[model samples]
Each structure stands twice: as structure tokens, then as C-alpha cells.
Target: MPTDTVRYGMISTAKIGINAHIPAAVKSHNSEIVAICSRFDGPAKQAAEENGIGRWYGSYEELLADPDIDAVVNPLPNSMHHEWTIKAAEAGKHILCEKPIAVTMDEVREMTAAAEANGVLLVEAFTHRLNPHMRRARQLVGEGAVGDVRHFEAVLAFTSRDTSTDVRLKPELAGGGLWDAGCYSVSAARFILGGEPVRAAGFAADSGNYGVDTSFSGLLEFPGGAIAHMRSSVEQPGTNMGEVIGTKGKIRIPHLFEEDTPLVITNADGEERVETFAGEPRFVVQFNDFSECVLTGKAPEFPPEDGLANTAAVLALYASASSGQITAVERV
Candidate 1:
């Protein structure tokens, strides 16, 4: 291994690891997938052979014990995040875990505690926040480009393939439209408004069929009097976009969580302008940033602590959905 380059053990042959991170690792100079692991030997061996990884293990423990690996990328199902992430931390490996970090506030605390105890870097994979589009949007809101942001709308919807077996549709896995997609909207609202919501109201547009939400809508009220209406779906098709409306203007994000997107701002006088960024995959950028953080000990702009607020707000919304009333955000 080259000095300062982070060697990763890719956990599971999950489609996301193969389709997104593998390609991203190829493009990253300081990051490499040195190994891969699955619960069975055959799949691990096949994935390793096909991907050109030098090492493959049948168990996560074996993968973690490999001295050649410096970190792990855990893209397991939502419910598995807390378990495997803590395991990776205990093994003295830094981690870049999938979004919605954990399903509950207690799990978030436990994961954070384990990482801090082990002196490992643990980051939630909200890669879009690392993109320039979101960075600039947050800046614009702060600079009054969207004067006194009063209202916002965010939506992320897509049709899933093989819903019967897809991990996203399983309730026991902590899967649902809100956990899979709406977390982005809630996080975006927090990012753009630069404040946490005081209260949240959620309504399940679709539920009971799968014991999880297929489509859902949520309303959040921020401390600064900003209101956000967000919708997410796993069984329907819709645009991935966000709009922040202010007293004097509004800013729009077309691809809310994708790296290759632009920001469109409209002023009180009806003038509009679009802000564009060069094309790049947010995941690739995230892969490289993980290495940078490992080697240089620099904190990510959106660190794991930031994810706590995100998970808390989502939990509040989930509680609201269940109780049939607006609920106060836990911390507020």
C-alpha cells in the first residue's frame, strides 16, 4: 500500500458498493478497495475475483482483522448500521457508513461513543452535503440571497425494482420511504435554514401494505419561523428537488442530493438566475474525502455529530406520523 492512502474493506457485495463505490474508488487517487467480504465465501470470492481486489473474506471479523485494511465502508441495511459500524470501530478502523446513520437517537449515541472510544473517524455518508451545490446553497441562505427564508419544499421519489425482495421495503430492516429518501429533505431543510426544527408533523401517504411507508409527507417548523413541506416515496416516480422560499426571494435545487445539479434563485421582483457546478459524482468525492480525513485528521464539513440532529428530526417526524399529531423535536 502507498503511504497516506487508505485501504478499504468493502462490506457486502451490495449493489451500491459495486455500482457506486467501486467505480468511485477507481477514480480516487488516495483510496482503494483492497478487500471485500460477504457472509459466505462464494460471493466474497466471486466479487473479489471480478473486481480485482486482492483479498476476500467470508466473515466481517476476518475482513477487519486483515492488517492490510485501514478502514471499512458499511452500506448494509439501515438496521444493520449500528451493529457493523460499532464493530468496525472496535476493530480500530475508520468508517463511512450509509445515511440515516441509525434508526434511533440511542443508537446514534452508542455508535458515536464507540467511535470516540476507539479513536476512529465515523462519518454518515451524506455525500451530497460535501458537494459545492449544497455548500453554496447554505452560503446563499446565510448571505440573504434568500432573504429570511420562510418556507421550503423538498421531494425525493423513485420507483424501486424488485420491491418484494428489496431491503428498502422491509420494515424490520428499518426501511421505508422516509428513512430511505425523506431524510435527505429533512437534512436539507436543516442545512439551508441553518437551524433545527422545533416541531414536526408527518402523514403516511402509503402504508400497511408492506408494514412500512411507501409514500409520505412531513411538515417541519423551524425555530426561526421557517416551514418546510417535504415528501418522499419509494413506489412512485417524482423529481428530486428542493425549494427555499424567503421573504424577498427563493433558491431552488434541481437535483437535491446528486452532485451534478444546479441552484436556481428567484428574487422578489421575479428575476431568476441559475448556479451551476462542474460534473462529478458526489460519492466519488466522498470516497476521496474519506481518505483525506483519515490521513490528515481533518473533520468533514458534515460530521457524524451533524447526523445526530438529522436522525433526531426524522424520529420526531416518525413519532408524529404514529401519534397523529405534531410532535416536538426531541432536543427542542
Candidate 2:
């Protein structure tokens, strides 16, 4: 690899890869999508040609073995995240992995250790942190626009009648509305609260097949007595939004995570404010941040540690739901 070029590789033709990440990588400055791999050759080759990428492979291992690839994006299913991330680390390739870093805390710990040992930068792509609007909301919360934050409210849901056994609904595939959508709510709550959640109380509905939750609602108690109530579901219609209400004033991210418009704020004086990210690409922002971290050896704002914390909160919620009691998140 030369100092003049940013060589990129992708591990899947997943929907996110095709729709969001690949386009962002191509549009990024001085970077090229060198190679991509998929279990299926048809889609992989099509995606490579359609997206103007250099080459396509029918397997992930071959892509990892390519020395020309400076960085690899892991857009595989949640269950496969740890295995391939470790492989990428071993191959000395910088990695940008999708959210919910791993299915378990132990797995996250192992992946983090491997990245550190292999000396490759590993980042979890949580696009909300890169959103300028969310950045402003964090600043407002820090500035005490909302007096000492007491309770937070977050909800994300959409209707999905598709019963084709997609990854989101299969426990084996690490699919669930919680991992699919709730990860965003948990990440937002953790981001705004600026600390790990200590306890969680939750309830989950079963689809009666694989035991994966179709919907989950939970309460996260952070340090200093701040509490966040969150919910996510695939059985609903359209998108639901979230809010961080403090004592003095409050910031309302009408929609968290996804490229939301018109983030609003209301103060005790009855004045209203809005922060807008005008015509911005959400995944592009995330790709830029990941590229900077890889190129400059900088720490990403949301790292694997943040992913671990969110996973802990999620596991605790599931446990609470099973036991019919509030469960505490053990520090990872």
C-alpha cells in the first residue's frame, strides 16, 4: 500500500453494504473499493460491477488474504462478527464492523483483545455519534440546557410483516428486534448519559418459534441516578423517535441514529430550538470517521468498548425479562 492510496475491501453484499457502505466508500476522497466477497458469487460479482469496485470473491478468506487491501469492512450477520473480525485482525487489516459488535460480552472481549494484539484498529459503526445533529444534542446536554438529567425516553420501531425468516427474526442468526433496533436506543441512552448502565428492567415478547424476542422494552439506570426508558419493536408501523429530558431544559432528537432531520430542544422558559443536518448522508459520515481513525491512528468516538457496554445492557434486559425481575449489568 502506498501513502497516496486508500485500498478498501468488503466482506459481504449485505443490504447495508449494497445500499449504504459501498456507496460511501466509493464517494470518499482518494479511497477505492478494491475487492468484495460474498458467500454467493452471483450477488457479489454483480455488486462489484454495479458499484464499480475492482474485484469480487466468492469467499471471505480470500479477501482477508489479499495483501493489497488496507482495510476491511465486516458487514456480516451478528453471529459471524466475532470470527471474521478476529480473522481481519490477524491479517493486519483495519476493520470497520457493524453494530452490536458481538452476541455476547465474552465474545466482544475476545475480539477487542485480538485487535489489540494484532495492532489493527477496530471500530464499531454506530452512525448516530457521527451525526452533526446528535453531536449538537450532546453538547446541549453537557451545557446543562437540560438541568441535571433525571429521566431519558427513547423508542425505535417499525412494522415488518415479512415472515420470510430474515436475520432480524432468527435467534440463530442473532436476529431480534432488540439487537436490530434496540441497539440504537441503548447506544443513544448510553451516549447521552455518558456512562454505563448499572441496572436494567425489561420485558420481551416471543415469536414462539426460535425464542428470539420480537419486541423489547426496558429501563436503564445509569450512574448518578439517571434513568432511561427504551423500547424497540418490529411489529409496529413507521419509525418512532426519542428524547433526553433534563431538569433545566431538554433536547429532543426527533429520531435517533438514522439521518434524522430537525432535532428539537425545549427549555423551561418555553423556548424551542432545532438542530438540522441538511441533506447529509449518515453512513458516509460514519465511513469518514472510520477512515480517519485508520489513517491517523486516532481513537473512534464510539469504540468496541461502547459496543460491549450496550451488549451488557441488552443481555441484562433479556435476563430481567426471563426472571420477572430487574437485572443488573455486570461490568465487562
Winning candidate number (TM-score): 1
lDDT of 2: 0.83
lDDT of each residue in 181-276, candidate 2, tens digit only: 888888888877777899999999965565688788899998888899989988777676778888787777777766656788888897997766
For residues 109-158, write the lDDT of model 1, one tens digit per residue.
99999999999999998766777888898999999987887899989999
lDDT of 1: 0.89
**Candidate 1: TM-score?**
0.96
Regions of model 2 farther than 4 Å from truth: 258-260
